[model samples]
Target: MTDEEPTRSAPPEAHAVSPRFAEYTDRLLFGEVWQRPGLSMRDKSMLTCSVLIALNRSQYLSFHARRALDNGLSPRELSEIVTQLAVYCGWPMASAAVSELAPVYAERGIGAEDVAPEPVPPLDADPGMELRRKAVLDASIGAVSPDLARYSNELLFGDLWLHPELAPRDRSLVTLAAIWAMGLQPLLDYQYRRAFDNGVTRDEISDALVHCAFYVGWPRAMAAAMVAREVLVGDDGEDHA
Candidate 1:
């Protein structure tokens, strides 16, 4: 499928239960939020899949897995996203996402070999990586745990973030979605800002959280919206000052 095509199909039965919800889902979520020009379909797909994976919403993952492919996310990129989430979310959640996508991959002729991640280059190859890592750690938690800081730098930022299959912007979107789904406010607050730093605009972040409400539930999305608003407002204040 081409990138311009709609990744997700319409519900088989419209107004099957609640017409209001179906209309909202069809008109607002899909029509407006997803169609918002700030974020690409690929970006939205990655964000949606990451949230679904983090929440262990396996039933919905299959549809998104197929959608992700249509949206131009490679199988390898999707696999790497699951791998990254294993560390950030949990092993079981990531594992379930993989299991949920297996059939979709098979149907598309994406074998295990096709989805295997490429070898990550050494950290030194990206000279600025350490500097960026230290800046983030210093700003957020002050790197209180030596081991954790090392892991975050050498593994999370060094490897996963640097993975060539996905751009840093895409990685930031995925990370934000996972943290939001889990309701980790501190991380959500940090990641929301990080998302902006990684090139996700404030409006895109807002739209993404609204899109997530349907899949991850309203409570988590509402909580995340507050964090996003705070981060954006703080940014605006800084710009004005």
Candidate 2:
């Protein structure tokens, strides 16, 4: 990742301020971990960007957006991600992410219309899972705010998640990143478990946690890593990867 602009990935003054931390950030995080084989660099970029957006860390978003573009995630696809995340991560941060990205798009002469995704029926047509989610929502938050439940069940899952813009696996990865980056550990078990259902592998989850360590900070990433271990690797001592 060659970032012309300063990003959290490789901070310019961190080395002078904290040499060892910087070395580990560069050599260990990027050098060794990122070079491992499971997740593509493109997926890493996308996940990182999503986490940053979720955490409202827009300062670093543009740099990673460039890396995402370099790694083959198209402008339209990114726009799609922003739209999806607006539901899951909230509209303001999603808007902030696009705020940084729009200039990158304009620099390349990519118009808003050019990046808009073609409409489609909701692709998340899993009735069984949909019903299960609604049931859970109804039992919990629905009792408090019925509208929230409807928006979550009827819109987020019924509509946005079903969209074909982002693949199920990619969507799962970014959603997991958002939950993890925000230090929302309770959601980790649920998201990590569902990630497998969405076709994200244990190894890829491992890679993602490591990737998040650099971008979101170690505390958030470490807590998420432990939760992933519990969720992905149970008492059988299995190498499920």
Candidate 3:
């Protein structure tokens, strides 16, 4: 099949179990939500795979892994995503995602030789940029864990974020999806702001939250909305997008 075709196929029994739900899945979720204009299918697929990975939903994760490949995400990009999430989500969850995607990669003939190494920026890449990134991390979570603050600077923003395989905007989207799906509001709030800083527009963030509502659940989405609202409106009540 061509890369454009969806890798997932609904089973006939799905329609038999609940016609209405099945219709919604096929017609609305896949047809409408997946076809939305604001986000490309590649972005949507990235979000889907990340959400499923965060939730530890192996079945759906496998499906979306194939779909991500079909939607134009290279195996190397997917590998980098897993590696990046290892820090944000957890090593176990990230490892599980990699295990689940192994067969999918094998199917596509993407072996270890084909997977690109994660890029490492030079130590002197930009001292000013590194300082700014450290300052942001310190401001956000430094009080809680100085080690975490250091890790965030050295690993997350320093290394993973600098990887050219996925654009910063797309990386922000995936990060947002993973945290939102896992219902981590404080981290979600932090990520939402970081997302905006990384070029994820307010409307795109809102759309992402809404899209996640279907997969992650309404309660979490609502909580995320409240956080977004608070972020958009500063302490002085000014809308800051």
On TM-score, the candidate that comes out on top is 2
Report the C-alpha lDDT of model 1 over 1-241, residue by residue, as the tens digit.
1234243335756567676666666666776677777667887898889988988888899988898899988999898899889999989998898799989998999987897666776323345746875777866655477677777766787677767776777788888888888889877766766667678777777778777777778998888887776766665566410
Q: Roughly what TM-score does model 3 have, to 2 decimal places? A: 0.84
lDDT of 2 by residue, 38-107 (tens): 7888888888888888889888888788888998887887887788778778889988987898788888
Candidate models: Cα lDDT each = 0.77, 0.80, 0.79
- Looking at candidate 1, the ten consecutive residues that score lowest on lDDT are 1-10
What is the lDDT, from 0 to 100, of the residue 160 in candidate 2? 77
Candidate 3 per-residue C-alpha lDDT over 1-241 given as tens digits, one digit per residue, 9 for 90 to 100: 1224342345688788987677667777776777777877787888888888888886778888888889988888888788767877899989889888888888888888667774555333456766776887798789889998888777777777777767778888988888888888887767777788778999888778768888998998898888888899968899987
- The TM-scores of all predictions, comma-separated, are 0.78, 0.86, 0.84
Model 1 regions more than 4 Å off: 1-19, 119-146
Q: Pick the candidate with the highest lDDT.
A: 2
Q: In model 1, what lDDT does residue 43 have? A: 76
Clashing residue pairs found in predicted model 1: none
